[model samples]
Target: MASAPPAGQGQQGAAAAASPLAPSEMYRNYNFLLRLDSTEVRFTECLGLGMRIEPIRYRESGVGNVVRALPGPVAYAEVVLRYGLATTPDLWNWLKRTAEGAVVRRNVTISQLDNDGATPRINWNLYGAWPCQWSGVPFDALGREAAIEELRLAFDRLDRA
Candidate 1:
C-alpha cells in the first residue's frame, strides 16, 4: 500500500490550480491608443471612461417610513484627454472653431493595447463628442515639465465595441 502525502501538500496542489490569472495576462495600463474620426490626433492620456447609474426613489403611502429605490437611467460622464503640446495646429484649430459658435461632433475611439502593445484588446467608442473645455498646463519659470494640453468632451453616448 502507498502512504498519503503530507498534510499541506494536497491543499497546495489544489490551491495552485485554482489560483487567479496573473496581472501579466491582462493588457498593460500604459499601453493604450486614442483616435478621432475627424482628425488623426494622438493623445498621451485618456480619462473619465466611466458611467454611473442614477437611482430613483419612491415612497408609498401604505408602506412604513422606508423608501424604495430603483435603478434609473445610466448617465455617462465626460472624457478628458491630455497630450503634449505640438506644433501642428489642427486640434487647436478645431477647438477654436467650435468655441466661436460652431458646434462640431466627432466619433472617438480609445483602445486598450494587448500584451504585445500592438493588438487592440478592447475599444471604447464615443459618439457625437464635442469639446466643451480646454486647458493648458501651468507654467513655472524655474520648473521644467512637459507642456500638456487638456480637452474635455461631452459625448452623447458611450458604447463598448
Candidate 2:
C-alpha cells in the first residue's frame, strides 16, 4: 500500500541533493554569534566563593518587545563570564527585594567605556541599584583591555583562605 523511499532514491545521493547548502558553505551561513566581538565583556558574580561557575539562563527582555512571555524591557544581560572569587563582598541580597524572586531586573550601569576597545573598566553598584528590586550591576569603568584584564585576573586569583 505504501511506496518505498524510491529505492536508492532516498539513499545517499538523494539526501545529498535534498540538502540546501553545501558543506563548505556552512561557514558562510549567518549566525549572530559570528558577530560577537572578542572585545565584548562577559562577567558573572557568584553569591559566594563556594558558588561555582555555571551557564546563566533566565527569562528576561531587552531592547524591543518582539519576543513574548519574557520580561518587558527585560535584560538577558551583557556581562558573560563566571566569577569564582571576588575583590569585594557581594551584596546581592538585601540590596533588592527581588533578589530571590523572578520579578525584578538585574540593574547594570556601564559607567566607563573605551571608544575604541571592547573590554573596559566596570563597577557593580548594588542596593537600590535598580528599580524593580534586584538587578545585576553593570560596568562603570573606562579603559581598554587593560582594566578588564586586571579585574579578570584578580577574579581568577580568588582563593578560599
Give the winner by TM-score: 1
Cα lDDT of model 2 by residue, 5-78, tens digit? 76667676666778897664443211111011122223433222122344443544673645334223322222
Structural similarity to truth (TM-score) of each candidate: 0.82, 0.19
Score residue 95 of candidate 1 by CA lDDT. Answer: 88
Compose the digit string of candidate 1's lDDT tens values, residues 1-161.
Answer: 96665577796665655768655675787888888894546788888889999999999888878899999998889899999989988778778988998988899988888988789889999999888899988888887888999999988888897
Backbone clashes per model, in order?
A: 0, 15
Residue 45 lDDT, candidate 2, scale 0-100: 30
lDDT (0 to 1) per candidate? 0.85, 0.32
* 10 residues in a row with least lDDT, candidate 2: 28-37
